[model samples]
Target: MRAASEILAVWHAFDDFPMETLTKAWHYRSGNEPKQRSVELMRLHRERYGSSGNCFDLALWLIDAFRREGISAYAVGHDLLTPNAHVAVAALDGRGRAYLCDLGDQWIEPILIDAGSGDFTEEPLAGFVSGARVALSVRDSWLHVVYLRPNGKRSEQTYDLRPIAPDALLAAGEYSQRLLRKPLVERRIYTETEVLHWELGDDASYLSGKRGRTEEEPMRSLADRVERIHRHTGMDRQVIEQALTVYGTASIQFD
Candidate 1:
């Protein structure tokens, strides 16, 4: 089994990586089409102009980073046919034990996946101070991850354990950008920070931040949304303006 100390180290290194806004215009503008190459995405992340992407972007970067550190890792996903599909990284420690490291999902620590049994629940690194509990159970060939907060609230995500190939993952990325009815794709500008979620839509702009604070404002014009994103995310002003000009002009409905 991978030592708890080692897993904790990797978890802390990537825990705070920002999950930025992704728009269809920005997706195609990266190149002729959505490019799923981790190297290119990582390069963009290093460049201030390239910090924004969806879950696949985040998972791909994590896979590359883990491999560079000599950890055996691969990209995994579930619900490929649905709009709610999600991606994450699976890492194998020195002792051949597998763990789930999902920065995009904002998991505080790596979760241990027990393969032999259909049910399991445990703290990531027992004796390490953390307020989250991870529980795994298998049903109908789907692995469910239940993340429980110290206050008794819980969030659950499920995925297939089968490893996803790079080409397949790339294709999935394209489908999600084009065909998936996701809020990320529908919103003119969507962003999630550590404690906030901002989405600009046709009718109204929604803002939700820490401590259950949520408010709505009249929809701002495309230009205004771009400026708001620029001011809020610290992304390049020119890049945001260009993307909004090219992609944000479409008429989209809000929920």
Candidate 2:
């Protein structure tokens, strides 16, 4: 029973979001214009969770929060044998337009896919999850990350694929079947200056450098990052519309 206020409180504590983005998000909720910047959302989420929030827990908290708010969403189970506990959110309006939103990357923008094809109108900043192939596409807004398994001659499939750690996924191929039983997904997000190492199950941990150093000033706060992302890409009205189109579907409608 996660409350929306509890979630917001977390965002407030960590100071994850910049003041402007935080202000804008609230505006979107209140029928005002929302800004374009994933870092703002990320920072806001961090502030909400304080220090206790990790990637998986934050995801779980979001699921519970969405359910409480009467929103529709699901966590893609990993496999038939064992499923990943990670979750992604989806909502649809009466017009048949659906939105699938995930806070798993630097691009805070909700990706717009055709629901039937695994194609993207705007490609994500990150690469595809590999080693294990999972398909999560739907006619509605809910897209799944699917994995296939051989059933007799043919194959049976499952839709819950969590983000795999790049190294573990690659290593799993070389290891014995017994040793490869554990799931591995790369839970990382790379910005211009920082590479956040998310826990295997948690997606929203504090960002750190990958190798030598990470850029500090640009990412010091969520506001700075949001402004930077906007400046770098020159977020236009079209991008804003796309994001609104996705979030606007969150409203409830009756038949």
Candidate 3:
């Protein structure tokens, strides 16, 4: 079991790691590389790029990280067999509570997923998805999350709280590691007023926050886009360059 404060200490460190966009390309040697690398590699790429992998990668990394500290941890996911599947980590805080640590979604901090605990709060928690007051609840074997945005709109999702087996987690991770859709990169920027989400891809990019979303023109030159991505994501220039080269450019998207 782990302590919430202990998990926070670990997450405080991981909070600096960016959610990477180039893992799939790096694994396939699709970028400006010579040959395909091992598809199962995660740690090497994390350090090589100075960031963490996507959702699955982040979950797996956190699980191992908690274990290294002698804490119990596991992976939980929903829609695992679908293209929209998402995964996150669940670590037991020895006190019989579990915290939902979702760095992939750029959560500012982990939130208590155990609603039965005396410390649980129904008040919406901010930063679980950045710029939103995320309300969490556990009932009927499911964890429900509601995102209250600054704008007059809200979105909801249900997370199956059951811990998934290691083999299933690995299988889903490998499948995701091999699937390359676009050169997508994400980063959460903190400011005195609010948190802004920067979402970038080969075809499109945007900075979203309390005021509103500002869509940037599609970057035509690969060099320019790579530089811009680096400025936002803190990924190495060479890595971003290679990833864009493999992903190529696409028509600008409006959505």
In angstroms, the error of model 1 at 142 is: 3.0
Which stretches in model 1 have alpha-carbon errors above 4 Å? 1-3, 7-11, 21-24, 115-134, 139-141, 147-155, 179-224, 244-247, 251-255
**Candidate 2 lDDT tens digits, 50-118:** 121222333444455555655544443232122222233333322333344444322132333345433
TM values, all candidates:
0.67, 0.31, 0.85
Model 3: lowest-lDDT 10 consecutive positions: 31-40
Which numbered prediction scores highest in lDDT against the true structure? 3
**Of 1 and 2, the candidate ranking higher by TM-score:** 1
Model 2 residue-pair collision total? 26
Summarize candidate 1's per-residue lDDT along 1-255 as a digit string, tens digits: 233566667656654354543433455556655445455655665475734566777777777777777788887878664566688878877766667776555554566675653333443332111334466775654677665555567677787767889888878766655541322311122235333434544344554333332445553566666666555555666766665554445455211
Q: What is the C-alpha lDDT of each candidate?
A: 0.57, 0.32, 0.73
Candidate number achieving the greatest TM-score relative to the actual structure = 3
Better structure of 2 and 3 per lDDT: 3
Candidate 1 lowest-lDDT run of ten: 180-189
Candidate 3 ranges beyond 4 A from true positions: 1-3, 30-41, 192-194, 216-218, 249-255
Model 3, 102-154: lDDT tens per residue? Answer: 87777777788887877887778665666678877778778888988878688
What is the overall TM-score of model 2 with all chains considered together?
A: 0.31
